[model samples]
Target: MIGRIRGILVEKTPGQALVECSGLGYEVDIPYTTFFHLPDTGQEVTLHTHFAVREDAQSLFGFASRLDRDLFRLLIKVNGVGPKLAAGILSGLDADQFIRCVEARDVNALVKLPGVGKKTAERLLIDMADRIKQLEGQFVPSAGGGSLPEGAVKPVTGSVSDARDEAESALIALGYKPQEAAKAITRVAEEGMSSEDLIRLALRSMIPTK
Candidate 1:
């Protein structure tokens, strides 16, 4: 089992990365949270990894922090939540916010994200409250955070990969093609932005004016 990877980051996209170690480049799927925190290509990075093996294929999932990896593992244990949805949840909300939503039983907030529904939100609340507390107790939020836990506070200043991914998906769900949304959001980020800001900017980009 590959527990961790420390190597030169060769390439990074919204949901994946290629890390080269000892002449072998390993492609590892990652969540937006991890994608946002990653260093530029060619820099050394360390990632916690989960190795999943099926009859036909082997896959590796990576996380920027231990909390993200732990949450990913816990998410898959919930009924009706697959790896993709788990990644989506992490992409949509940070760990601290997610825990609060579960604790408060906020089905509305949970359903706001793509793919999650009321039933799934209720199940998540019922199935995850206890585990959320356990994980929260173990993590220490970084100083200066308003409410976000340190374990969940991914860097967003320099890189917009994660923000871009979320904005693109949000735009597509609102009625746009995959490529169109991605390009528009990338433009928004390049001009200086956050996910919320990108959402607004992308909306303008999508408008057809005479």
Candidate 2:
């Protein structure tokens, strides 16, 4: 139940971030939507988090907004949905977009999300339409953002190949097959695009709106 973390962002990949707080680095799994909001490698960032525990593992899932985090809590309670799938869903669509889809019964939009098939999409619409009512008035900006740390933080630097490699790795981590990730990256990649841009474009290609 670690609800929030404010610290220096040490590292950020498309699916994860390492935040150093009080001299300890916390590895927090994040969705690409949250990833898009991250400041450079060394800045104060605040993430609304949900701590998950099981017999075998523990994980912290972080979100850029309280609404997204709250929606995530409700999503995990849905039948057959778990934290990983819920994270993937948020990566594709933030909470507002997701709520609209559920309200509109947009199965096509949900199905386009990574790892979600038609049956699962329909399930989300039916299951979440009512459960989402609990999240009213909760959309707020994350705290500790737009501020620098006490000391300077060295930025992470990488080459073009590095960006491609990181983007592919991130997609694979999100449950896409290696082949699929590679193909998607190859299809959208261009010279000088950062890993974030590459990942965003690839996901958009996979989950187009029209």
Residue 48 error for model 2, in Å? 0.4
Query: Which has the greatest TM-score?
Result: 2
lDDT agreement with native, every candidate: 0.73, 0.81
User: Mind giving the per-residue lDDT tens digits that candidate 2 earns over 62-120?
Assistant: 98777778889999998888999999998887676687678888898888777888888
Worst 10 residues of 2 by lDDT: 146-155
What range of 10 consecutive residues in model 1 has the weakest lDDT sum? 201-210
Cand. 1 TM to true fold: 0.75
TM-score of each: 0.75, 0.81
